[model samples]
Target: MSASRPVRRVDRQALQGLAHPLRVQLYDALVSEGAATASELGRRLGESSGSTSYHLRQLERHGFVETDPARGTGRERWWRATEEDLRTRGADFEDDPSAAEAYRILDTEWARSRRGRHESWRASRREWPMPWREAAGESTSHLRLDVEETAELMAEVVALMSSWAERTDGRDGDPRYRSVEVQANVFPNGRPPGVSTD
Candidate 1:
């Protein structure tokens, strides 16, 4: 699906605003499952309507989510993710300890949520159609590269995903189309081959 807006680079202020675990979960739900009202989200997330509503408002204030204009009435208030891809770097907050802590919190929660989604998919893969079962899965590649090369590789991967998103922009209502998650992890192996910690 197409983003309603362009890609958003998350600043320190936004990062701090979105650092809460519940808020992150709420935003993730809207992104992965489309729009829903506070009560509906509460039911799915096992949270109180009041809690979800409060957290959703926080997410909205930081521009991570927005009211779904097409879905609910004025009182119902359906919420959906803004569709903008968010990019953040730990380096951005290196000078500010509190901001760094906020980044860490958001990063940890985001990674945990992603892992949970993959685990859920794995658990239910057998229930899916044969084509999807065969097509969807994970992969890893080991490469020995310096920092610059690694960055270049990630940039290419982002470009590829963005192109695919553009290619499938208007296919939201198609029955065969599914919400799929594609994750990429690039990092140095712990300690490296000849590192000395002592």
Candidate 2:
């Protein structure tokens, strides 16, 4: 949340490197788990250790992750996310079809990750206290705005989210504290019924 690390803006090369579903899965695991050995991540993702290690090195080459020296041993290496957050702008690859395809693949993986998390939360909600169960749910809103306005709104929301992230970092010692996932997205809707732009 309040990570001292800067958000890494992924370039096309990195996007291509992460396009594989398994690599995307491994990257997410490394970020969420803080640090992990290839074997540990492999177990979580149902992949072989050799495969995970190969993909982890692929991530390292693209600067998405790195060796966690403090957590590594003589026989095993630990890896961690290089950045607290990562982002890519599809428009950046507008002229390159291959890069654009890579972006799409990564996007699909991101959506899958979100769906998995949502399902997991729903499945486990019963184990949580009533207060938490009541507080956890989805909210949706639709607004009409020009491109500039939409950009401004997204920036504001990100700032607000960052503030909360900063505040929650040191509360791990609290018995009642639990990690919560926050997802925010705003994009232009595809052609609605009775609308045409072609």
Could you tell me every candidate's TM-score relative to the true structure?
Answer: 0.92, 0.85
Ten contiguous residues with the weakest lDDT in model 2: 165-174
Whole-model Cα lDDT of every candidate shown, in order: 0.87, 0.82
lDDT of 1 at 171: 60
lDDT of 1: 0.87
Residue-pair clashes per prediction, in order, are 0, 0
Q: Which stretches of candidate 2 lie over 4 Å from their true place?
A: 1-4, 169-177, 190-198
Off by over 4 Å in 1: 1-5, 192-198
What value does the lDDT take at residue 72 in candidate 1? 75
lDDT of 1 by residue, 7-125 (tens): 88899889988999899888888888778899999999899999999999988888889987877776889888887788999999989999999999999999999999999998999
**Top of the candidates by lDDT:** 1
User: What lDDT does candidate 1 reach at residue 157?
Assistant: 94
Model 2 gets an lDDT of 0.82
Which candidate number has the best TM-score? 1
